[model samples]
Target: MTAILTFFTTLACIVTLLPFSRHPHWAIRGMDFPRLQFAIFIAVLLIANFVFLNKQSQFTWVVISITALCLAWQLWWILPYTRLWPHEVKETKESSPDKQISIMTANVLTPNRKVDKLIQLVQIHKPDVLVTLESDQWWEDQLKVVEVDMPHSIKCPLDNLYGMHVFSRLPLSNQEIAYLVEKEVPSIHTTLTLDSGDKVRMHFMHPAPPSPTENPQSAERDAELIIVAKSVAKSNQPIIVTGDLNDVAWSATTRLFRKISGLLDPRVGRGMLNTFHADFPFLRWPLDHLFHSQHFTLNSIKRLPPIGSDHFALLTKLTLSPTVGADQTGLESNTSDHNWAKEITENQSISVNDVPQVDNSK
Candidate 1:
């Protein structure tokens, strides 16, 4: 039993440390996702070690030291999102229907087919804009009920799991469907004119994850985001980027993206608001996200009830108030951040023709 426990502890420690290597391989990059779960495991293992190990041998001491280091590293990355840290986005001091924009983003898990559940939520929430990920033709047909009210939309439905559609009550202009990194994957970009005649630039993306079955590397995902980040950095317009990022809130890549784009996450110091793996209570994490620029302040954020999909929908209301920017501060990109962004972007910036394609066929 002690031997087994030692092996588990060592493996966990290695997983915790691997993300630091800046490698994009699926196994190495995946270590960035489950820091919270690993932290819990570290605590349990420490307690087990104390209870089960009868002797204070050198091996036991070494195991304890490794576990402690792993615990510290995990906590270092996750602590910023907890209440123990200050919020990066400020709450709205006041909000009005005209100045406020409400959005609901959901990953419908393509095959789930629980359209009624999502429709019911939309009826109740009545958000100004709705974004759905992993939405194929079937999901598009099911969501047409919302089109009657949200007349303006950008639909890029595909049989591929990367399909996405955006439905909105507000006016949409300059709409584009971009295959930024991979040919099969598409991202939505457009300008939304709110009720108050305010225009907000919006980018909706559901980049393929770093997984054995998917791209097998984080390079494309990171590059896609950095490309967007570069655009956002150059734009003076108010911007909102939302979707299932596949990357976590605290990952190094996400931090760099936020810094470059100057967008703020409402989840910081608010809550983890885990939105993925809706069917599993034990293995869920925050996969869906809503990020906006300093021109807006958060009114309220809600993680809606599950709709038989793998992810829960996220609804957020924000007021377009530039005055709020004075009281708020966003992460600023440093020299290292810029260099890392450049490195990742250059590494994955292959032309569509030159890009190595993933075999979608199982």
Candidate 2:
């Protein structure tokens, strides 16, 4: 029994350390998804070692130390996302409708046909912007009920399961569909004009995940995000990028994206708000994300109830305050982060389609 426990403890330590390497293999990158679970398992092993192990031999001490170290390593990455740490995005004391915008991002599982539940949530919240990922032709048709109120929209309904559509009540200018890394995957890039006449650039993406059945590496997904992060870095406009990123919030790649783009995650110091694996409470991570520039102060952020999809929708209300960026912490990037960003972007072999032309004449 002691040998088996020691073996599993060693395995947990190995899995925890694998994500530190720069390798893109699914097995290595996949370790970034379950830090919380790993921490819990490590804790259990530590307790079992103390209670079940009668002989405190050298091997027992080694295993216990490894379990403790692994737990600390996992907590180092996850602690910031919990209330115990400071929030990366500051919370606003109050907000006016004219200066605030609510965004709802839902990755409606392509095969799940319960579109009415999503529509009902839309009607209830009436967000300024609604971004649906994995939304093919069927979803586009089902979501038509919003056209009566949300006049400005962009639709790219593909059968490849990467289809994305954005519906907004606010005016959207320079609306274009971009194939950032993969031609089959479509992302929405546009400037949303708030009621205050300020323009905020919005980028919605659903990059393919690293899985056995899908892309076996994380390079493409990482590169697509790096491309967006670099593109937004050139502009001073307030930016909001949201979607099912297919990566967890605590991953090194996601952190690099946030640092390079200077976007703040409301999840920091709030909660995990895990959205994926809606059917399995025990196996879930925060795959759906809403990241924005520091100019926005979070009003409210929460995971909406399940809508018959594998991912739970995320709703975020942010108040746009031009001076708020100066007050926020941890949004700045260092020279090393920028250098790594360049390396990651240049190393990607994926080809992106030419930027789609946007007509603002409407």
lDDT per residue as tens, model 1, 246-289: 99988988988899888889989888888988888889788888
184-225: candidate 2 lDDT, tens digit per residue: 888888888999988888889999999999999998899988
TM-score each candidate. 0.93, 0.95
TM-score, candidate 2, is 0.95
**Which has the greatest TM-score?**
2
In model 1, the runs with Cα more than 4 Å from the true position are 54-59, 350-362
| Predicted structure 1: lDDT | 0.86
Clashing residue pairs in candidate 1 (N, C-alpha, C atoms within 3 angstroms):
none
Cα RMSD, each candidate: 5.3, 2.5
Candidate 1, residue 123: how far the Cα is off, in Å = 0.3
